[model samples]
Target chain A: MSSPAEYAPTARTVPTRSRERAAYDAETVHAILDDGYLCHLGFVADGLPVVLPTLYARVGGTLYLHGSTGSRPLRTASDGGLPVCVTATRVDGLVLARSGMHHSINYRSVVAHGTAHRVHDPEERRLALDALVDAVVPGRSADCRPADAKESAQTAVLRLDLAEVSAKVRTGGVNDEPEDADLPHWAGVVPVTTSVGEPVPDPGLAPGTPLPDYLRRFVGA
Target chain B: MSSPAEYAPTARTVPTRSRERAAYDAETVHAILDDGYLCHLGFVADGLPVVLPTLYARVGGTLYLHGSTGSRPLRTASDGGLPVCVTATRVDGLVLARSGMHHSINYRSVVAHGTAHRVHDPEERRLALDALVDAVVPGRSADCRPADAKESAQTAVLRLDLAEVSAKVRTGGVNDEPEDADLPHWAGVVPVTTSVGEPVPDPGLAPGTPLPDYLRRFVGA
Candidate 1:
């Protein structure tokens, strides 16, 4: 059973057996999506599944994939809409147990299954590109030069609505068997984290171009 | 044209365009695969692509997916050989440029397209499970209780040959336009790093179970 804020389970979105770790709430799905940096995009081609890693941004309920106009997925999305499954995963920790069978990783992942289409509307495309830039570094779009007409034409933005989405998360600690409780093996969870280091300036930076506040905060400089 | 020690590029395996940063060398492919912890496994289901994040380990030229027998992908693979595409990506940094069109992420990703079949051989399945546990925390398989017959029967594994594989890598700094080089915007890369924090022991642990040497080294304790 799903809560009011959760997306109703469909035939495909339901968690197979361990429904405890899976959630379909909007808050859960959005949190996982926002915490992610890259997403693996999957689509069928020639009757075979093809998956590629790409950058994406979520604005409200829609996911925008930014790429060059010549890229295969972007091209395919432009030819009407393309069916896709986009997944974002963040590893939290390594769960160690007394038994190998109980070992697992603590992670938060969201999967969105839907159809993606190229954003042909000029206004939407421009905003999507800005959103993508901002996603890379928060508040980055304000400092950068907006894409001119030519650059806009050379880029493509694919839009996928977050309609059928579910998140599966593994949190807390090890689940060792009661029979193996007396084993000598140490069991626990080692936390994993992602942090941004110092910014690496381009070789050809303008003299006295101050680092933006957003960049400084992002890198904790 | 692929060099020796590289898998021959098929129509589907070839990089779509700008193959300069894409590689097929076994060394490159294997290195990227080994560095990754989880992979987004994709397969066609209900005439559409379905991608799920799962634990995987590589042994030579084969990738083994470890999961419950009740899972959808594992069940489908056991039906027959399932056409699958597995992709692993590691984000290195955020590349911020002076123009929105030039912004991108520095990442290393490997995509493998092949058919995955259930590992029916008992010995192979045992080794595969061991490899998976070791992949999570190196040397962990030796420390934990090996999966017994009942545990092995409950778990399922899918093996996919690394026959069609390609690796795409993006490195270095921002690629800003010469015209926008003098822009006031500060452009560079923010390095993203993954690190392990202190370990938290399980509540039901045997008193003073020493941490394994590998675990100590892994967590830099």
Candidate 2:
């Protein structure tokens, strides 16, 4: 018998035994979520599973997802809460190879398993929307106009509690087999990274308008 | 009552009635999967959930996943098949904001729900590995040295059948609310994209080795 917490509604997808490397604690989960601005949300739709890549923000222990009211998924949740799985991941490096089979990638990722409820409370939705903006670019919210009643009415916000979530990571140099390690093959992390280049100002911007300093302060991936 | 096909072992993440925009057909799923080189895989581990971003290749209806044999999840799967969820996403543009909350990203993504079985059959594993390499760089695999027995032993390959899957997408210009549309805020897609810069040749390569056409044929994202 499975514990109540482990009682998967549909059992086949749940693992029976835990793998040491696959497990992660709360702190690690929070760290990955904090660093990522976008998340891939997985959910069952109709009889099929769908993934949506969208902007999100972490507030306290929950993730807030926002989208247009015209979007089917968001509208469905607006009328009532729904279950959603969200995963946030970042690629840290590329594993180069001596052989095709040995090639791999280095990455860090977080998965949240829970239900997401529509944020019916107008105030909470407003704050969550702000958080979403800030998550993409710091100090960006203040520079832009606030959402008015009609605009807010046209959007939908859903909150997924990250009560049961985990983070997993794999990094470092390529793990070439010992025998092949001695072979003269170039094997190491190629170091794939994402960096914000100098911001391109809008063509119509006033000549004196300066880019925000926060945009320059990038976090190490 | 649901159709037998819909009797999947996962809960509906979005309201069944509102999944129209969130659900995609098989062709859309394969298209999204085929176009991307990396993916975000999510799975439950140790009562928690996690996501890992890694490189992948889609072959027919199966996805070939590569990682070190020592990787926790891969290792566990090598010893025994494990249930896992995988997703691949591509970003097409960034929605810039007049306000932070309105800023968003436009993307396409595919999610799969299935168990991953380690490839024990050497020949099949080799093909899977080759497909992965070829997926990254079309002609590079043949140019690279083949993996020997020892090297193959240290690498892990898992195949996930793309049975339960769907792709969702959002694209086009920013949909600013009417009131905010008139606000003195610059709102439009920044049109972010990924493209291959000129390939820097390896310093130690033979002086006469011409860059392959495959490497030069990269189209913008």
Alpha-carbon runs more than 4 Å astray in model 1: A1-4, B1-4
Q: What is the lDDT of residue A133 in candidate 2?
A: 85
Give the alpha carbon lDDT tens digit for every residue of B1-221 in model 1.
12248877888777766588888999999999999669999999989999988899999898999879888888888887889999998889888888887888888888999889999899999899999998888888999999999999989999988888988899999888788988888888888988989989998876686778999998888
Note the clash tally of each candidate.
Answer: 0, 4
RMSD of 1: 2.7
Residue A51 CA displacement from its true place in model 2, Å: 2.1
Global lDDT of each model? 0.87, 0.64
- The deviation in Å at residue B147 for candidate 1 is 0.8
The clash tally of candidate 1 reads 0
